[model samples]
Target chain A: MKNIWTIAKREYDNYFASPLAYVIAAGLLFLLGGIFLIILQGSIQQAIFGGGTPVDIGFINQWFYYLLLWTVPALTMRLISDENRTGTLELLLTAPVRDFELVIGKWLGSFLYILSVIGVSFIFAIVANYLAEPGIDQVKMMSSYLGLILIAGALLALGTGISALFNNQIAAFFVTLALFIVLWLLIGIPASFFPSNPAIGDVFRYLQIGNHYESTFNAGVLYLSDVIYFLSLIAIGLFTGVTAVDSRRWR
Target chain B: MIRVTDLTKDYGPRRALHSLSFEARQGEIIGFLGPNGAGKTTTMRILTGYMPPTSGEAIVAGYNVMEESIEVRKRVGYLPETVPLYNEMVVQDFLKFMAELRHIPNPEESVADALNMVGMTERAKGYIGNLSKGMRQRIGLAQALIHRPEVLILDEPSIGLDPGQVVELRKIIREIGRERTVLLSTHILSEAQQICDRVIIINKGKIVVEDTPENLQARLVGGERVVLRVRGDAAELSAKIEQVKGVQRLKSNPDGSLEFEYLPGHDVRPEVAKIITNGGYEMLEMKTLSLSLEDIFLELTKEQVVTPKKKRRL
Candidate 1:
């Protein structure tokens, strides 16, 4: 635990020390702000009896949750891959710290960075509340943010695990992107192809990250099952990363 | 306080190290000499517990590398061939990180001492990317030393350094060796000769020779070979010198000289002089060839190659 905290502090400090982390944070916030502005404009159009609904604001924020799935990989691709490429992995492996400590430290560091970006995007929620009199559902807004954070956390862990498999950052990013795409898009294919067996469809829907994320985001409900699913993904990702490091020693 | 016994590592049938064994006592500096791809780095990695050997065992500072890796890691400091550093981190920050990783209780003092030891105190606040290669190398050494480990394993620590930087690095290594066991790998023969208490030359996944540099040099004194520049019928003198007792072999040089490899403890200079004077050959110059580390290395490895081939067939 002590080693984990030490590694975490260093990893966290690195995000602020290097331009890469700041660039990622700034780019994410900019995109989030732009999306929020578009949603706010649509909300105004609906209020003035034009062509949209107030619920469109909720739908736009849901899209922000999906945006996080893609953006989180960019922040995580270099966490372990760059370390391996630069040979610093050898130094870290030889240190007295355990493998799990290193993995947890990197995961927490990227998580905190993502959290800060999500925090900045919350400014848009405040802006939307001030620009109108109908007001936003504070509970729903917080729940959506919570859902986004959980999804991002899970994706960052998966990205970190992928990064540990290769020394090239681009390869890590693309491989992770491909995996997430397959899991997200192909979740419906199994259900459609095996419709005669409804159990398979039920399992596929449960496996779909988008399904679980939207369930929490749309209803403003933090289901224990949803929380467990994302937490399990994070655990699996970090465990796989630790195993990768351990296997390299024997390889 | 390091001992490796029957250590073998195979990377999918391509063996990197084969039954390699050596020992380093406390306060001894052992030089690991090998060519590129000769398993120097692999052996160092195993010693440092960065990687595990496929077979056999190693004990470092009273801890087994595979069984007690964490304990071993705590007792050993390692600087790999490439100075692995976080380029974005400042020197002090990186050292502190390393200290923490090594589980140093007093990280502040450890970082300061490491920086001071490597003469990197002034550049402690400078980013590693902005530092020169030498400075980065020093920082790497500092990271390794931050925990004050009992045994230090360095793989080509002086590689990629200018002559001046190499000297300074060697000086630091020598100073570090005074109180700890140091197992350093390098292909530079002179570097090993200058600093090593003992040298182990590894070739083709095996140790070809192991001895003190002076002892190894002394063993290469093959009965004194003499190069003589003479103004005479060199071919005839070569033929005549071959007939002299204790003269093992004689060859005539293109420059009208006769070179002789005499038997052990025999000085055939008088015989050569007598032959030249009586046969009307002018002995312009005669010089004894001194064997260098290169010659010793070649001789040892050459013998090693022939013996191994026979053993493999057997």
Candidate 2:
């Protein structure tokens, strides 16, 4: 446990020391802020003319969650791959730290950093409350934020796992981004392709990350099953990462 | 504090270590003398718990490397051939991280001690990436010593250092070896001769010979060989040198220099020079040739190549 914290601290400090983390945080916030303004403008248009329902500002997270496909990969691509390239993997593996500790520590460091970047989007919620009619729904906003954090955890864990398989940062980044894209598009598979088997479509929908958030957390409905789904993904990703690191000893 | 028995490692189809076995007691500096691809790094990795052997066992500081890896890792300080380091970290922070990884109770004190030991106290605040190669190597050593492990495994520790830095590093290693078991690998013959109490010569993943540097030279070359260049006729000089005690098998080289082999523990240079001068011949040059690691490789390879061919022909 102490080993995990020590490794995590080093990895966390490393993130802040490099320009990559700052670029990621700044770029992500800027893009999200632009999208937030557009949504706010559209909501005001509806309030003035169409007489639509009051805009739930927290729903902006629905759009922001997709950005993780880029942010998570950028943050995690160097976690283990950079260690391998620098030969620091040998130092860490030869130390008294366990393989799982190293994996979890790296994932936690990136997870915390990305969470802070996501935290800045709270400004959107505040802006929404000030301009909207009845103010933002606090329960829905918190649930949506929780959903985003969980999914980010799942994606970051998977990205960290993939990072362990390659020594090249570019390769790690592309492979992880490609895998996340596939997961994002899984829900888009046409029903005509799998005619006669609706179960396949259901399975794809269940696996699609967006479905869980759009249905449960975004709608202010917190389901135990959805929480389990993200947690299971986290477990699988972390397990594969630990195994990849341990396999180095045999090779 | 380190013992290996039949330790073998096969990287896919190629065997890196062929049942290699050796041991190091406390307060001993053992040098692993081998050329590149001679399984020196492979052996050190296994001993440090970075890699597991394909077969056999290794015990480091009273812990089984494979079975109790954490315990072994806690007691072993390894510096790999390339001196792996975090270039972005400050020297003091890096050492403190290493100390924390080793679970030291007092990291600040340990880091300070390690910095002082390697004479890197002044560079503690400097970034590792900004440091020169020699200073980076010193930081590498400092991190290894942060935990004050009972055993130290260094692979080609002085491979890229300047001459002055190499000398300083060797002095630090010698001081450390006074209290702990140190196993360092090097291809340089003189490094082993100067720093190691015992040298193990490995070739193609197998142990060729293991002994003190002096004993190996005496046993392999049979004695020291000396060459003398004179300004006069070689015939008279050779005859007089053969008469000196312990000089055996004197031969005249094509360059007109007299060569002779003398038994170990004998100093025949002064006597031979005296004879050359007394015979009205000015000695132009005289030097003793020590047995180099290359010579040992040649001697071993000759046997390996010949026996295999003879068997194939039969």
Q: Give the chain B TM-score achieved by candidate 1.
A: 0.90
Task: Write candidate 2's Cα lDDT for B93-141 as tens digits.
Answer: 9999999988899999999999998888998998999998888888888
Model 1, range A72-183, lDDT digits (tens) per residue?
A: 6777888899999999989988888778888888888888877877777777777777666565667787777788888888998998898888899999989888878876
DockQ measured for candidate 1: 0.80
DockQ of each: 0.80, 0.80
Model 1 chain B is weakest, by summed lDDT over 10 consecutive residues, at B305-314
Q: Which candidate number has the best TM-score?
A: 1
Span of ten consecutive residues with least summed lDDT in model 2 chain B: B305-314
TM-score, A chain, model 1: 0.89
Instruction: Name the lDDT value of residue A61 in candidate 2.
Output: 85
Estimate the TM-score for candidate 1.
Answer: 0.91
